[model samples]
Target: MLAIINDDLAGAGRPESIFISWLLWQPRGVDLASEALKEVQKLARYEKVDPDIARLKALFASLAGSDRSMH
Candidate 1:
């Protein structure tokens, strides 16, 4: 499942590529889903501002709010 998403992300390009990078670089034992959520939050907070990424941040924020497993 994750491999499929990673392939789709690689094909799609840009911000998704960033997500793939994050997914690959996470420390051992970190939860992949939670780390992905944190990566989305960090992208909006620390990276150069991108309107498209800001929109993605909004969506991720909503998902994180509802998904207690991410916390």
Candidate 2:
């Protein structure tokens, strides 16, 4: 099961796919918060207006800025 997921991530290239890949990596000790933060900025710069995306960007910004030790 994990092997299949790894294989998919290894081949994914779409922006959303890459984001999902980063999300999956986060739980495995990978520090994806920075990447997520950058992605949020990219979305905002491009004028993406989806409320959900905006909310996600805000969440990512908060996560990226917050001290991890507190969590």
Candidate 3:
């Protein structure tokens, strides 16, 4: 998933822990602690949703379903 550190993600003097909140709401946000693979500040500057993020959400949903095959 492409991670973008736009203004929303980075507030003025925003604590690092804030990322935890974002991840909590978005279960697909994996590997957030590592160095960002992609940072499109401009791309996320005007919008809230990004393509990579949407795909990640879909991927996470599939993974969740895969884990529940026993039922």
Candidate 4:
């Protein structure tokens, strides 16, 4: 499943890549947070609005916060 998402991510555009990153993060949690964050940053660079982007941002933030608390 993750390998499939990574393959899709490699060919996806900014928005689609961001969505794919979120999919990559779902089962993996903090391990994939940086990948998702990179995608989010790429999307932010375009100054575009995506209905699902906010959810991705929230998910990354939530994961980051949890990851930090673990250390």
lDDT of each: 0.49, 0.50, 0.36, 0.46
Residue 39 local lDDT, model 1:
50
Ranked candidates, highest lDDT first? 2, 1, 4, 3
lDDT of prediction 3: 0.36
Q: Flag the better candidate by lDDT, 1 or 2.
A: 2
Best by lDDT: 2
lDDT of 1 by residue, 1-71 (tens): 12213255345434445445545676999766565577555655633455556544444555455332222
Clashes of each: 0, 0, 0, 0
lDDT (Cα) of model 4: 0.46
Among these predictions, the greatest TM-score belongs to 2
Give a tens-digit lDDT track for model 2, residues 1-71: 01112345455543345445557666665577676566556656533555444444565565578532111
Give all candidate RMSDs, comma-separated: 7.7, 9.6, 12.6, 8.9
TM-score of 3: 0.27
Question: What does candidate 3's lDDT look like per residue over 1-71, in tens digits?
Answer: 23444466444223233333445655475664322222222223323365544333333333344322111
| Ordered list by TM-score, greatest first | 2, 1, 4, 3
Better of 2 and 3 by lDDT: 2
TM-score of 1: 0.41
User: How many clashing pairs does model 3 include?
Assistant: 0
